[model samples]
Target: MQSLNEILLQKKIKEIRFKAIASIVCGFLSIIPYLGVLFALASWILFFIVLYDLKIYGGTKNLFKNLFIVAGIGFFGILINVSVLFVILKPRIDIFGGLYFNEDNAFLAIGTFCVLFYITLALIFPFFKAFYYEIARVTKQKYFINAFWAYFIGICTLPLFGLGAIGVLIGYILKLVAWIKFKEFDEQEIVNLEERLAKEQKKVFDLKWIKITMASFIILNLLVLVFIIFQYFISFVGLDYNAELYIRRTLFYIATILALLSVFLFCKKLKTYKLFIYFLIWQGLSVFCDYILFTPPSIIMSKTAYGSLIIVLNLCCIILAFLFFKSLVQITKEKLFYLVFIFFTCNGFVAICYTSLLITLNHLVFEKLFLVGIILFQVAYFISFLIFWLKLKGQKSVKIC
Candidate 1:
């Protein structure tokens, strides 16, 4: 009979294969109207995770971090592309600075739009190149380049109308094919590392409670965010604005409190869970200390003065936090990367925003904007954070590999 390790390894291999196929399905789903961005986001994240999982099979180092270029740059491309899709659908819609193209000026508008769009595509091509090029380099899937070229050619021929459309379709097909072709991995390598791999699996297994608690916390947090966002649409006509605001704020606070409680049963033995706790504590302390000690209204004489103070405070807190990150805790680079890139960077932006805004007793916009920023940041971080746990959830039971 096969040993338990052998059986578990078999399951893991099968899971890796399943996830690759699932990623393709998600990519396909990304074409669906209305929900396309959601599906595409899921696809991008899932592909990142699949490569991370393939680490065991391919033994490729820094597989996820190598794509930092893609993630960092691709993020902007996402906004640009989403804007393009909007323009394509609503060609005459007002864009930046009261600018728009209208059917009334069909010929000129069409020509101008085509040129601008080609320019847009031109900007996007580098992102596409980096995306496929890095994947090809890491996964050794040379055909990925063919997909990139197909997309490039498609964009180049886009001004050609009909022919360009075919090129784009071909590119997508090749992309899907490339994604589906990841079934082969070095099975022998996995067999060689069986013992150590088993240990890794066990470490992952011990993290199950953490995974569940975090998942609950994230879901509840998102629900609260959505609830708050919907309040922006409420028609408070003939209603007491103060009462409505009170109700909205009360519900939000309650939801947040419940989200915190859902994760209270967490195991303290795993230092991993403390990672988020410490980061949050760092945020709270930094905000309180910086706002209190440094920025008294007497010192905030000029706009420049206020802005300068806020920037210095944020940077100092960040540098101090980095020191704590280095000395007070043991954490992985990837985890540290998330803490800095997502949480700390976001907090810095929020702090700077608050300082720049002119706040008065009656001006609630600043407070609302801050709340929105906080929720948006949580949404961004939790998406990736949830994926981290899911990746670990696959880990079966042992000691550190």
Candidate 2:
């Protein structure tokens, strides 16, 4: 019979294999049109599982704990900034007429928000550096350093078109190299490292529950996709406004409910990261606000009130997308760069444009622009997915070992 240490070592090896396979799969699936998001979400769960396993069995608790602390602080800073903005802008919000900020007030608010945003960035940078530095140290490779610099440069040159893309591509390449090296670490060293973990007993997670939850999530996503298709078809057919609104609202509400349930289940099972929960909260609120807006009599709210609610929801969605991307980067780093680009260009831009549309609903030009934006967004996502699938299919899978 195998000794306890041997059993543990085998388990760790299996997990490493799983993580490598998952990363590869995620990279491949990220190119698929609408389904890429669902696959990415699943990959996030797998990444979290790998992290948890590493924390418990690989003696990397401090590294993960510190990373989580930094992430939490960053999230908190964003919340604080948002709260402050709300406070500053509340008086300027004319419930009946919408935002009425004068030129001076608008400038002041923008300046203040920018200052706070920079401060938050400054505070978060060191933590990220430390995290990357540790990964490099563990892997005994300088690729992570390359990734760090590349990503930093990318962020700095974000205003430039081609420059940012180049930086991102370089960063992603380095990150992939680092991850591959980390996965190929000496087995004896891993066994030695796990010795320290033996002293601390950890609870075993039920694999069955995880499978069930994931299955449910997949089903919910499919339902959502169906609803989206039907709704789009209705729009294309030029249905009556009342009929279209009713169909859209009903399908949207149902889809939202299913999405919320799936997210809740995943959170309950994982219980580690709060990013998913934060997203769920914002999503639910957004749907609720939409409900209010679409309901008859306008729920006794003025146009300004409805618009503000939509704006808030869109802001929350933007934050949610940022968190999602951050979480993916934490796991895949450079390997996620291309998908990250697609997400920002498609979903992220959609959110921003939608928010702008909500803010200027009265403007015919803005309304027309939004319609065009939506079509472009869909096309971009589809093209990205096709590219990913083609590239992945063309490549041969290399053994991790």
Candidate 3:
């Protein structure tokens, strides 16, 4: 009994020390804003050393397996993020002014890439760790790497024409299957830990409440439908100036709905749900913030200043969207990775051209260009819908046949 008491006291002391060290480290990391990349690198190095020591001391096979799993997740995250980044930034090598793929620019780009990498690890590592505990002896990090590598190669094999798009779909399916197969975790560790803990972790958001609230909120937003109807009426009646109010009101109402969705999404604990939610949120927030912060008079200071601010904000939004997707891939829905990547990439490209498109479309000739762009967007949407339908049909046929 005395020996058991001593052991318990020692364990308590160790836990206290561990928590204190963790708190200090977290405090220091939080203090540095842009230094998160450096901070994460340091944390990872420290983690490896500590884990190595722990593995040696315990001689636990599970520890080594967990190390592999985490490393694999890190690799998967880095590959997916960097690949999408390459697609987005590759086209702007010449036109973006400064960084023409020079060494300094390259270093900056690589360093910036770490921003996404670190953000992903920070958010998902705990989940992976928790998952590691749950899966017990069956969990191995190599499985995740192998799964990701296979998916990467498949994507690389995508055909250059529209078949490339089909390749993306197949690649997505392959990745999804791999993850599902590899997600074989044992809940024994979690159950055992729960027996020792004071309390179990509580669910952050209730799904039932979420559903009910969203449905009600969506119903309330039908007033925006009325505003949109009023806009057509004003436009048809030749009240050109009144039509501007209708348009503004219509957009504002849409923005409000988007903002609400974003808030609900932001509150969500899952990344995939947050991804689409944040996308709408950013769009809504940008429009709403711009309306409030930059009236025409405020933006008339200098053309460069206005342009620079908008560019900076748009870039910030793109980064946020990436972070949102990273969270989604790691957390809520891993299957949505390719779709999320393509959607964000397409939207980011649109944002980059949005202001220019607006400026040019003020001319009569550009009206045709605007119409063409709208038509193209519609066509792309229809094509995507058709592909989705075909894939669904294929899935059903496979299940049946």
Candidate 4:
């Protein structure tokens, strides 16, 4: 028996090594020009390798069960890329843009799409892994169905990817802690506390930590966005003005530092209520800084280049503020009624600023088009949110009454 166990473990280790090598090879193959077909083959090979690796571990049944989930996600992604290519390229007669495509622009589009897709997949992969592990741990029958439900959480939570990344990171930490806890439980005389303790411990992962981590990421990404906007305006609008760009760049750095410090404080694991209070304080100060520091000078230095910066700043603040409000609802367990009002008000502020800025710049069509998209998103989200709120309220009221 001991010899057999040793052989099994060696085989598993070898399988893991092979899978890792195959994954790396496939990653490299994906970047070669005119090799997308080969890349797809490598991706399929990588998928099988992953499955084989899982089987070599204790997760053979899990790989079998959740195969559909793995296939569905990957296939959908490839399908969307294909759809986009067909839609964009089919109309243009330029071979680079069409059936015989050969332009740098076409290659650029393909490369950019591939990079973005992979980055998105890399970010969300952990959630899928966690869900698979949980399904195997928690259920004995209908493994596929259970795994699908868990995976559905990831799918449904797409809009919250910015926030979900925080949850997923916490989930990774919990995974390590969970393994330790599982070992501890296995050694204990008492076992009923396992699930209870697992859940109770997660309270430490409450909303405050999530908010701070998310805010830090958003701020950093915003800085990158600002730089890209600066470059675009400079390139296209002939706004080769260096002083304006320098000021905006300096402000972006300042915001990034503040965001980092905010994240550090949250990492210290302060009490949730205290952290919430600090969040309010920081945001209030941010508003002050925005009005006093960024706004006045941005206006006084008004030019086409600066206009883009103002628009970007306004968009970032509005979106971040909306997310903060959403987090408050989730944390405070408040009714969604209040959130609707808040969302509208927040977006109204964004629209007003955007319109006023565009009007000041005399850009009518651009402002109108942007406002249309904003209004549509808000309206659609509002209606969907109302339905959800009503359903939740009914469920609660029935339980109480």
Top TM-score model: 2
> Over the full model, what C-alpha lDDT does candidate 2 score relative to the true structure?
0.57
The residue-by-residue lDDT of candidate 2 on 248-297, one tens digit each, is 56655555544544444434444434646565555555565566555543
Model 2: residues with Cα > 4 Å off, grouped in runs: 1-21, 24-34, 83-110, 156-169, 186-191, 194-401
Error of 4 at 382 (Å): 25
Between 2 and 3, whose lDDT is larger? 2
**Residue 111 in candidate 1 has what lDDT?**
66
* TM-score-sorted candidate list, best first: 2, 1, 3, 4
Tens-digit lDDT string for candidate 3 (1-401): 55663464345334333532443364357346433433343344334433442332222345556556767777888788877666545634465555543353565566566676566556555655543343223333244344344434443343234344554445344433433444322333323432333222232333444444344433333443344445533344544545655565555554444334433433432422445456544554455445533356254555445545566676776677677656645653344444644654564455446655554444444444444453344344334422332232111111000
- For model 1, the stretches where C-alpha displacement exceeds 4 angstroms are 1-14, 30-45, 62-66, 77-141, 159-165, 179-183, 186-235, 238-401
Task: Tell me how many residue pairs clash in candidate 4.
Answer: 1
Clashes of each: 2, 2, 7, 1
Candidate 4 residue-wise lDDT at 94: 61
Measured over all alpha carbons after superposition, the RMSD of each candidate to the real structure, in angstroms, is 17.1, 17.1, 21.2, 19.5
By lDDT, the best candidate is: 2
Residue pairs in candidate 3 whose N, alpha carbon or C atoms collide under 3 angstroms: 68-141, 69-141, 134-186, 135-185, 135-186, 271-328, 272-328
User: Weakest 10 consecutive residues, lDDT, candidate 1?
Assistant: 262-271
Against the correct fold, how does model 3 do in TM-score?
0.33
Q: What TM-score would each prediction reach against the true structure?
A: 0.40, 0.45, 0.33, 0.25
